[model samples]
Target: MHHLVQSSLMRKKSMASSLPKIIRHRELHGEARQLNRMTCRVRLDQLECPYLVEISGVKRLLDITRECIFIGLSNDSRYAVGLLYSFSDSHHSSSMGHDEDEAELNVIVFELSATLLRPVKILIFCYIFYTFFLYIY
Candidate 1:
């Protein structure tokens, strides 16, 4: 009976940790990008603007890609969610001065391959238009 209780407690602990992992931010340093030609993967729901998505490093390069900013409307219709990229510049020393010394840091870019559901398409469309307004205004 004691062993049964202990197992049940253990099971409960595991169940409590099943929430989706949220990535608050990510950083990549020099040579880290070259270490592997990685891709970022994102999954979002079409109907819900601001659908939650995940980005991870991949090993291959592909044509389909996502922009740095992702915008969407919440189901409640009262709020919006924006997935944005923050840029950072890192400097390394070299004899080359000014232009030659400059090292460009590319944005965290990713490609899309699989088909997105209708809801996901709507979310992306809203995101694009929202971004457009921000730029225009």
Candidate 2:
């Protein structure tokens, strides 16, 4: 039992030492992007969109006001979620509209699970949109 523990400790030390250290945020982000690109086959560039579609019983629009922001990893890093501010405009108008300024904060969660047996590379899990309204006084 003592020998087994010692061997396991040695293996852990070796493994820890073999891993490369990332000291900068850019480096870490780059590494993560690279890993995501290689494993998911979808580049991070594609995520920057001004709008997204919510598919339920009826299709809805999630209008993004700004660039999509990467939140972090989820499900033990098997997935990643992004945050974006969007608005729903049910009405179409030619001039400046009242709904144009309305926006909602939403989190877009996507699956990053990649496997040889699985046919799909990436799948959108869900979009959690917060209804809290922000009004300027």
Candidate 1 residue lDDT tens string, 23-108:
11111221111112212243444222222443222233211224334343332222233343322223312222223223332222
After superposition, the stretches of candidate 2 with alpha carbons farther than 4 Å from their true spots are 1-43, 46-52, 55-67, 87-98, 115-137
Task: Extract clashing residue pairs from model 2.
Answer: none
How well does model 1 score by local distance difference test? 0.29
Clashes of 2: 0
Model 2 scores what on Cα lDDT?
A: 0.42
Q: TM per model? A: 0.22, 0.34
Maximum-TM-score candidate: 2
User: Which 10 consecutive residues of model 1 have the lowest summed lDDT?
Assistant: 18-27
Give the top-scoring candidate (lDDT): 2
lDDT of 2 by residue, 1-137 (tens): 99999999987544432112211222356433123222233345434333336532235444332445767654244456666554545563214343444555555665443321111122333333446888999
